[model samples]
Target: MKNKYSTLCYQFKQLLNTTLCCTALGMSSASLASTHSLLIAVDGLRGDGIENANTPHLDTLINGTWAAGYKAAFAHYAQTMTDAAPNSGPNHVGIMTGVTAKKSGVTGNGNVAGGNYSTYPHYLTLLEQSNSSLNTAYLVTWGTDMQITNTADLKIDANDAVNTQNAVNIIKGTYSASNWPQGTDIDALFIFLDDVDGAGHACCFTASDDGYVNEINDVDSQIGQLLAAIKARPNFTHEDWQIVVTSDHGGRGSSHGIHAADNYTIPFLVTSKVAKQGYLSGIPRNYDAAPTVLAHHGLAVPANMDGTVQGQNIRQENDKGIDHGLTTYLPFNSNYEDASGNHTHAQVGGGSPELRANGKFGTYVKINGKKEHLTLGKPSELDFGTDTDFTLMTWYRVSGDQVGDPVIVGNKNWVSGANRGTLLLANEGNGDDFGINIASSRSDRKDIDPIDYTFNGWWLLVASFDRQGVATLYAGSPSGELNIIAGDISNVGDINSELDWNIGQDGTGRYHYNLKADLDDFAVWRRAITLSEVRAIYNNGHGSELLSLMNASH
Candidate 1:
């Protein structure tokens, strides 16, 4: 009798579990049907272009909430060489692999003739992971030739008008669009528009760049067509949906390549099945484009990916949205004229970075490779860990003239008689490793973990010091991931020394030096920036793009 009772109970529990799972599935289907996601990359869109053009379609996009903008920090980013060389291979690899060209071991578009060169460490698109369960497909134009075919189930050869119309038909409620792959799959579609970057290169970024503008308009019209198609499709309303659209890089000198502001800037946008969330700003790198689909389908982001969730901010969020209140009001660089009457940007911390040492305001030396002194700017002080929650942000273009990276130090009171003092952070040249100094003395050292920055051509660096003196440095995403690509995990901000604070100076007395690049948009906050805030930086609101179009030549 006892055995029978136990058996009965086990069977009952199993039956209950099955019923619950089925019920969950039903709910998911209802939401999933409405939750269709699309990721789009508009080749060569600039943050500054939005302000000067008639981008009504993008204008409708809100700069926060479902989508936010964030700036990216890359050393070298460009569009293409020529019509025959319409290759953004490294950038495309950055997208599908979520790893930068440097990190994924795929450095440039192609250094050879008629072949793909992205195979040192084979990259896995988020699609090949758990997202396999979902119907994932990549549709692209000429830009796809760079690398999309080598990544996943991406198509290159297709009739543009027909394929677009077919996609539109599927988007609308028109009998599920007979041409689409059949299944109850949670589909994530990614597409790219090559006309923007391609045309932008031929034409400069100005009112005269009508060809690029019209191309964007054409993209908008097709998007509208897709919207209409989805609305017409049967059972389409039952699936959940999200759409992400962005660009790879912009143009410079009426062309692209090399580490120029125009060539490195791009666009990222996302729209949920419901609600028009608006513009997302400040997207970090081209690689951040994929993790949305991967994370959505419950796949882990590859350890090597430099992408961030800020790419896909569209969610099924209802009721007033989460309170994403993170703001930092620090000006990057004010206007400055040189001795030759030529214009150039000043060191950002303060205006001119010129400080009076012996009671003279103009008395200052160049700490960061600048020939001029910087005043009216925030001086970088490394005495941290005092604030309960502090975050630092800066936009910098490192010139190749780098002695070494200056590190932020802690434990001020120990090193100096006053609060504390920081030693210069430098590569001991002992090897390709980095170690921290407690005192200005090399012998008085507490060896930190070895870091590799040989590949840091020029990227934005943001370091956050949490409460417990546990410091984490972020090269790409501020709140995205601690490691940019496949980098380091040293307790960077962890300082327990009684030292004084310093800026731009390293252990060897070298400065926080870098050559070949421009820097701007420096900020610091008292608290951690929420995910929503990260999205805002990607849009046109706060830090949508790093450089200003007015200073395009700079």
Candidate 2:
């Protein structure tokens, strides 16, 4: 029942995935051998704790100094489940099953029994189901933390020392027959260290706590032993191994399960020859671990999983076209400076918007609905006259339903009949839609059909107008699926206006339609970007690093 276009798109997506997998593995699809993955979960490991601890082994993994010479780990200050308590049970379910507490039905440590693990089994179980010949092992310090399905070939619940030893034994193919079937290869292994969490509960959870830091240091030593064993494998050179290290949650004052940053902020790290170097371009979550492991093995991530592949946001050759005609770019990475190098810096107009550390791409500006706005002061670069092709794009996430139709970005008064220039508005006409309004005058306005939008999530919105008076609107989901709608707007005359360019509100003195949302990566192009360029900027939900794309040779 599918159309030709849809079928072709699906085939293209599959081809792209295969190409990317082959490139990452440095082998053809048919030549790829059994890949291996080691997932290490350090309970209550804060992002700052890693910085404070004396962990040389972890440092090498983070900095990509391993014997295999893999790329630097994609280390990120990721968050736990935002909607659920920052506790072990919920977070572990997320890490193992790639689902949030809402879907897993495990809201806290006390009610892990209520989880839907059968429906949403661990990634290892999924892998086994896909390929029964593959072997997997799970070793954890806490017996009660057995959230994963009993599908792994070997499951060991013991103290940190025992678990670490068993992990090393399995990696070296020296595990006893009584512990694990001899000669069985572990394609996927998960190790959980709980002593750090115990140390946090015993005293303080901050990095200043000597006991907590020491416990982390001890875990690092265990990790080193496991890494050495992996390197000692006879076929280690032929095997593609990916090591992922992350934490369920952080703690504060010997307790956690709160919404505070100290409780939710944790570390997500991945070290592999195929992994992209340096930090992830976007905010990562604990749930991303499962899909990341699955993707490393060239397995398809289930559509039901909420997590996405991590550390694979490498720039492709198609991304080089993203910088074409780009005139203004606002990364909002702790600043409002234009990354496009046009010097079209933003100036604070009303109350200052807060610069949030965890944005979709680096830092983002949080705008309160109450009078907070930013202005570009009518830069000539943003002035697109009629017949001049232009494109406006931004990534935005609204906190919730707004009290009024909010203007996300515009360069006009936006008054009907007096409207000039183009603007992107959210919840226009009190509807659950994003509207793109392009007008030359009040009577010569053209409004594209509203596109449905979601709240409390990142989305990319693009409005491109061609000299032929054709306007195209694209709404991109976090997963890189784009919904497009286009209309002919040749009826409109000049869209150039003298009004100052404004973000999160209309630029005029009338502070109507103020946006209550987080905004990042706002940009403007002098010409309408191609559809492929739009996809490149979206970057499969990782979003593009504008400067990197701009500097890349086409």
Candidate 3:
């Protein structure tokens, strides 16, 4: 019996060894790896051009969780000697090195006469320096991009077609296998498509011109081919790939270099499992790609880089509060609940408004179109004393298409009730001129330029009044960016602090017009918040989660 048991154990051990040997023979180096990345840069692509181009491959990325949608990035640069216009050389360098041309000293498209990559080490340099074994490659059409990085293992100045095939071959172990031991040896691969830029230069960027659109469509097809090749790799499933596609800068007509909005705005799309789906809030600059790529590989961003890893980093930074001068916060979700520590609870009066769940962040209150209103109970905290700085913030969506004045929030004099609060006056006098009016003080009133009325969409409204009686109104629609309106106050005197602080109704002593709007995240600050801070709130609901706590209170 002992001899029989020993023979069975030996047979089992031999079978296990054979299985292990077979597994080792079949598996590649990437099977045990964590992540890989592919960064593609398209030169001279416009923000509006993609809207006309049929890019189904890019559409998948934009509608998915990885990308933050259109107009997701900006090229922030002033005209300098090195880059007088929105040049690709400096912009691509910025994307690779994570710094602007001013800091990196690589100012123009022409290569530096006597310069080593000392000030601005390319992203590839950072990657290779961090991990010597990580394979990196850069395939570009322009020769100037060569000076940006010194650490890329393979640098090929080939056409987009050849580069695409080379990338596939590298992944398939056919091209330069001596350097890359396995088919999937490359860790990071960058491919530049210059056809679109060439097309733009050849023919003016007319939307009707097939030449320009055809180039974009052609590049999209090539990208599809590259994606197929990567997927077909033997060890594709084992490796995690973060695909990022973006443009260096946009162009106008035949030229691209200028400080205009059309030239600076470009499309940026990224795909990964952990990315959040939506328009990236705040503002994404061109240089953010380098840090983001570095972050994907679990590499630390060097302190020297100017750009930040934005999309994923926002969540982490959000955990730590960015409330610089947050005073009174009333997240209208659930109820007229104030999230700020200050007890500025809403006093429901005109009608019994109920909480609904279709709000931007959480739940919002439904103010009936009749005479419904909610007034802030404590007036001292909201009313900035005589000539004091103040700002009003809220997110609301109009339900009814009322042509009359829709008073969102009001603080009027108890005596005269002249228009001394914030009101969204739609179709007031004009058929479609929707404007905002704010009475800063008892007799002082400021009128903002009218915007075309929009309904059924969430709108962010911010009205701020400084001590000097200058008023600024910023409004952001659901899809559109923020719009600014500035004006001076007329009669800057004592504010009527004792009056009722109202929402969804014009409580200005005389008028009782109610607003049929879903209001949420209403906040009032003692001091006027900066424009950047206002933009932050509009881009990403920076502190809207406090509304959950407000909901819990109910």
Candidate 4:
């Protein structure tokens, strides 16, 4: 068995090397030749619409039973743009630009012309700017509602039938126009169909509606036609093709742009030789399409984009059991509610901590060093007996002004030779060190060497305790690097006390040290979490909520 220190070092080194290489090269080093992507956006296609309509092509693609010997597809009942109106312009911009309305400035269909498209343009435009040799095409059925066609070598605005036929002609290398008498090679293509949304707006938007179902069926047939055309290519065997199908938003009776699930839930599907079979690991957002497309072609996803590449770095089946022993989880997303379903909510005392909108994962609680703190009343589940293994972790951002010893989390008094519980402190015998103090009784306390702290930055602090009283502390930086310290505290037999559990100050109130920092994603587990699980939660500085980890594992 590999130790935690060596395993963490190896993982960090490998990740750092990959990051450096990708940064220096400006593109993925695994770029392949003759690769192509066909992204299809079917407007207002609900998750149930596919199941209710006759979509053999979609079924075959999703089930990995394509007669042409293609690999299985990755399907997801994904969510639309979050915290934005469920409108075509905003959702479409999110789908093509990998950003929400907050960044893209396309709040609705009427305001698309005034969007920030120049700064956060479509992925096709980025690709053209990065590599002009790669041919790109854009075909939309709703006229010029989409303003991202500037960089496409072939841009078309027509009805769904005309656009589908043009895409097929392009695939077969028989396309010609007034500007270019000869057809050009196509590498990436985006097709937008709006008839389904039109049908919904005309009448009702339900799976039971015949008009809506008929439009879906027609689109499925069009998709079938496109697939057949791809397989019919003369050099099909030599070309790698990826096909992505999704929708902007769903709707209710003749209307949308609401907060209801019917308007926000949509279907997302991806089929290719290298795609993952069956459903995606987690629920993806509409904005993830652009990054996914860019990553498929070995292009770099720009830092300005807000989307994450789907199906990348997914947790393996064996590692999905990370949440088995999770006892308490505090997300601190505008509240102190416990997300672990344990109901161990924290109570505010003294002055209420300010809830800030920006955090490592979500909203965080801001603590000013002046006596403000949160108290988690003594819960029996948190009291680990003599030899039970446990893990405690939290993400904190220091304000850089430190006075004396401050407690990040503790359940006992911090009196010398009288402590009786575990406390993770910001300073241990020194000003700029993070350490843990575990004690079963007065003389049984143990304080290990503290890890150096960097102020004005976010860091993940984790402490795992084994049945043998051996403790390991892990400090993770924003750069994906880790510093670990281990020590034997077997003399600290039962580090459980009757005092209440507190955050940002000592529980027993003996020490007036209050932590001046922002905190988020605090959790406790009955069993010690493995090193890989720690890395999964860390997620290379983009910390994940517990629910996301659970969903990925499932």
lDDT of each: 0.40, 0.76, 0.63, 0.76
The number of clashing residue pairs in each candidate reads: 110, 1, 1, 0
Residue-level lDDT tens digits of model 3 in 325-413: 45778665556656677677787767777788867777778877667778774367666656667787778677556646666776663
* Structure candidate 4, residue pairs in collision: none
Model 1, residue 462: displacement in angstroms? 21
TM-scores of the models, in the order given: 0.47, 0.55, 0.52, 0.53
TM-score of 3: 0.52
On the 0 to 100 scale, the lDDT of residue 265 in model 4 is 62
Question: Can you write out model 4's per-residue Cα lDDT over 1-554, one digit (the tens) per residue?
Answer: 11222434534654465567777878553442268899999998875577667889888887777645465544324668855888899889889999999998888888777778888988898888878757788889886455653577778889999999999998876777743223455789999999999999988676557899899999999999999998897667667888888889877778888754457667777777677665454446678889888988998898999887875333123343767878888888778888887888888966668888878776888988888889887898789878777888999888675678888888878765366888888886557677878888867776644556677788898887754534657777775555454545555678778887888877675466777888888998887665567778887666777668877876
> Sort by lDDT, best first: what order?
2, 4, 3, 1
- Which whole-number lDDT from 0 to 100 does residue 12 have in model 4? 62
Deviation of model 2 at 378, angstroms: 13
Candidate 1 vs candidate 4, TM-score winner: 4
Candidate 3: residue 467 lDDT (0-100) = 49
In candidate 4, stretches whose alpha carbon ends up further than 4 angstroms from where it belongs are 1-33, 67-69, 313-554
